[model samples]
Target chain A: MRVSYYPGCSLEGTAKSYDISVRHVCRSLDIQLEEVPTWACCGSSPALKMNRLLSTALSAHNLALAERQNLSDVVAPCPFCFRRLKSAQEEMARDPALRQKVEQTIESQVNGNLTIHNLLGFLTERVGMKAIGEKIRKPLTGLKLIPYYGCYVVKPPSVTCFDDPANPTSLDEILRAAGGEVLDWDFKSECCGAGLSLSKPEKVCELTGRLVRDAAWRGADAIVVVCQLCQANLDLRQREIGLTDKKEYQLPVIYFTELLGLAFGCASEQLGLDRHFVDPLAVLKRKGLA
Target chain B: MFRLTGALSEQEFLHHVVQRSGQNLLECLQCGKCTGGCPIASEKVSGPRRLIAEILSGMRNEALKNPTWWYCVSCGTCMTRCPVDINMYQVATALCELAQEGGIAPSERDIHLFEELFLKSVEKYGRVKELRTVAAYNVITKNPLKDMDKAVTLMRKGAFSPLEILSGWAKDRKVSRIFALARRTSEGGHE
Candidate 1:
């Protein structure tokens, strides 16, 4: 029930709700969480364009610290950090030369012995759905929730190696376990144009607009997400998307952990029901889950 | 209408790309699956199919000059769906790195500027201080007030606060070493 948690930079700044809800739910489930000592940014997509050596080095530095701490199982709640940590491990394991180069560059030895896991995997495997269902004091009965995994959570099987690259089901299974009415939607794992918000905000609107449009059209009450960037992009930009498209799309984006906390009978204050830009509390009240 | 003079130099460049990316250009079967799934392809001049062909055929300029790489989100949709396991997303990332090194003006300067700011911010604070990252990026990009409205909204909602900016500085002594060493290797020191 104990694991080392890596809540990346996004969790603190943009996705504070995720960090809060993650800790709340884990404490409810009695899963011990130990954060890494002095973790740095994993460099995200920006580093891929800046320098591979730097990105890999940053991730490897954190991994080495985890190894130094003797934590065998490392879990990253953020998909971007999960992917970066796994990539560093894969690169170090596959290419000894590159591993040596990275070690020399970062001045740290990554044993590559840690098991890197994402949130979906942790919830489904470590915290079983059966156990979760048992904890639900208030089943999300009438709440139509679409579990949005986004792109990086599961893709490029060689890199992520977590779920089916094309057809992922862990998020759906987790949602259903929490008594949510999981709806079948096509944009489940689609791209949400995360970093494009800064570079080309309009493009992000178009891409995320399609996602929210589909969820709303499908009659889902709200979209439940696991990634912070996706939550921020979809939740923060949803109003503008509605304005630009001139549509009355009022879908609220809720973090999966928040919904899980709701099911566990945790109060709204613990769930961060008020943190979202579009505000999911109204939707929750409408559905009577509140 | 394609020029065919600098094949050797193009081959060398392709070789370097293959070596850096660790994904073979020849493994790509021109399957067009990558091009078909690319979100940024519809608006770009060329998609992954043509970009891979250009890289393999020694058309380094054609491959590097294309704006497709600039707009790529590195979403890995193309990489995952490719039946041949080409990993064009990684290849596209390599092209971006090569473009930056070769003095190619990125069709989107904001992306490059953001990259610089992200790296520097992490290097300095050991974590991203959102306000500083925003100020540094906007200062250089000449839109000093960019995203100010959004920042205010996040602050009002309590999602962003200036207090967390230096929360990790106390334990940053070891984290600082990682960046210092990476800088040494990046400057061609014992790679």
Candidate 2:
């Protein structure tokens, strides 16, 4: 199955590992990711707060690009980008006049009209977990993963249109496909204080400390997330927090796609396992899932 | 039994409350789950769920004026735990925005100070420069010594790095775009 892909900004940069793993996993699943050419930033998180119209227009431009490509479903790995693009699509689809307005606004910014899909939705709805399960050569039998949803992926259901706002089951379904056990946790949808991590590292540290500590305490071998910001926060910031607090927690945070790649028997380099601040290969090797 | 007489009609008031909170005020089961799950609500008299009802029932003036809204940390606990999935943090943010729009000055000095410091950091550096931003905040708030010991201790432990605090081009691009967008939006009054 082939679908248009929007790698967003993070995927090309800091979270390039996620993009690599996603491409590898897609190949393993026999899925083609035709990347949306010349897509701009999803305006990030602050765009929504700054100018609703401009932010919506920024996302709409990407969607419009996808539409031009005749790719109805565009897979986005970053939850923030997913939320922004999907929310813009939903808003535009609901209001024709709004769509026209945004199109006019972003006519020169990006190419084509688009429809957006977060990785979870694309995998579950389009690819089907059944197909994914069939491709799992190395089943993660005893590997316990804490699925961290973060805030953007499931909130304000009007835009996301993926899963239950309070209780999402799509990630859990995907994890189960790889023969992995998911823990029931409250912080699943909790904020990792993403952008605030820079502005307010103390608060970020405090919040991240709680999340990491909770995942570790719950006996999770690793935490899986879709957002680059969430991954960076839980994976990298946790180390800083542990150091500052004099607490010892070297919890490995892995992208959901990386885990899927491992389950599909993809190489460690293909999953970019070494690039992570926290090495997850040791844990995967120990579980014999690598 | 108190009555509220306001410019907004009852339905209009209810709609406004629901729009801000993104939850059906009338559909609330009054289970207190919002209050129960809220980290800040536990420490305050007016929890989010109760605040929603109060705002919906034409207690607009009081709800708009309430200080409890600012206490919300935007942690998403209340929204996640709510059986009906009410976004209480959004409600709190809306109320705060409304207050700001109405020219209701912030009671606490930290609000403006933090905002100024944060915006300045974003504008000048294109990303948040932690040490500089914190230093500016401390200077403006007159609490320069606060967190100093913790900072020193962390530095000694090699947990804090000057390089990390200095915003680089690699880190600045994404953050710069966000800031530029924010500035444009704020200037447009569409925020």
Candidate 3:
């Protein structure tokens, strides 16, 4: 139940709600999360685009730190970090030349043996739905959600090697076990424009508008997500998206962990549910879960 | 016996892209499978399929200068559906890196600038100070109030503090070293 945790840069800043909710949910689930000490950025998308070696080494440095923790598993709540860390591990394991270069760049020995899991993977594969279901004190019976997998958590099948690339089922299964009605949606694994929001807000708003509109059309109470960027774009940019589209869309973008925490009877504030741009509590209250 | 100009031949251009991306560009069938799944592919931006075609045809300037790659969110949706499993994300990354190194002006300058600023933060602080990066980007891009509304809301929610720039986590020499060493090794240290 104990694993090293890498919260990534976004989790500490723009996605602080995800970090807090993740901690609360893990505590409620009795899953011990030992944060990797002095963890730096996992190099995210910028590193990926700037230099392959930089991106790989950045994640390798964190993995080396994780390896020092003496744990066999590490969980990254941010999908961008998760992908970078896992991709580094995979590339290092497959190519010893790349491994040596990464080790040299990081100035640390990377064993590349530790299992990297995105939050959904940790919850489903490690914690299991059975264990998670047992702790749901306030089941999300009336709450309906479309589980948004986004991109990084499950893509480029060679790197992630987790879940179905086209249609992932882990999030849906977990939500169902938590007693929420999981709506079947085609946009589950769609991209929410991610870091593009920083450079091109219009594109992100356009992409996010599609997701929000579809979720609303499907009659979902909220769009459930595990990735920080997905939550941010889907939640933080609702106003911009609404303004551009000239439609009143007040859909709540809830993190999967927050939903789990609520189901586990954790106080809404403890789960950082109040931090969302679009108020999720209104929808949760309407369902009588708050 | 003729002196040669510096232009890369078609094969050489393709080879560089292949080596840079580490993807099998030669295996691409131009099926447009990648383009079909691409989110940002459009009339102006031909997406992955066209980029790959440009690379195949040795149109180095076109491939590198294309704004399509810059706009790529690295979604990996194209790779998921690619019959040959060509990772357009990596290919776009290689093009961007090549474009920067080769001194070609990026078609999408803001994205390029934003990425540069983003990496500069990581290079300096080991971790990105999100607010600081955003503020710097906004100021540099001449839109100081770009996300003023969201910033105020996020500040109120304690997502990040104005004082985060002064935090202890901003300094990490080891992470800084990683950036320097990686840059060295990536720049043909093997040679």
Per-prediction interface RMSD in Å: 1.9, 6.7, 1.4
Superposed model 3: Cα runs more than 4 Å off: B1-8, B165-169, B189-191
Task: Estimate the overall C-alpha local distance difference test score of candidate 1.
Answer: 0.80
**Stretches of candidate 2 above 4 Å error?**
A95-101, A107-115, A184-186, A239-246, B1-3, B7-32, B38-191
* Candidate with more favorable, higher lDDT: 1 or 3: 3
- Candidate number that wins on lDDT, 1 or 2: 1
Report the lDDT tens digits of candidate 1 across residue range A1-290: 78889999888777888999999988988888899877888988877656778889889988987787677788899998999999999988998998998998777688899989897798888788877877888888988988788888887777998777667889888888888899998887888887777777777888899899889889999999989888878887777888977887778888899999998998876777776777688878877887
Model 2 error, position B52 (Å): 5.7
Q: Write the per-residue lDDT of candidate 1 for residues B1-191, one digit (tens) a residue.
A: 23335568755777777877778776777778888877777664477888888887887778888777777777788888887677765776678777766788877677777877887778777887666676777788789887677777666767667676545454455556777776567656222
Please give the C-alpha DockQ score of model 3: 0.68
TM-score, model 3 to reference: 0.95
User: Is candidate 2 or 3 superior in TM-score?
Assistant: 3
Best by TM-score: 3
lDDT (10s digit) by residue, model 2, range A156-273: 5655776886678889889988889989887877778666544455656777887898898899999989888888778767657778778788788888888888888888777877
In terms of docking quality, model 2 is incorrect
- How should the candidates be ordered by DockQ, best one leading? 3, 1, 2
Predicted structure with the largest DockQ when compared to the true one: 3
For every prediction, compared with the true complex, DockQ reads: 0.61, 0.12, 0.68
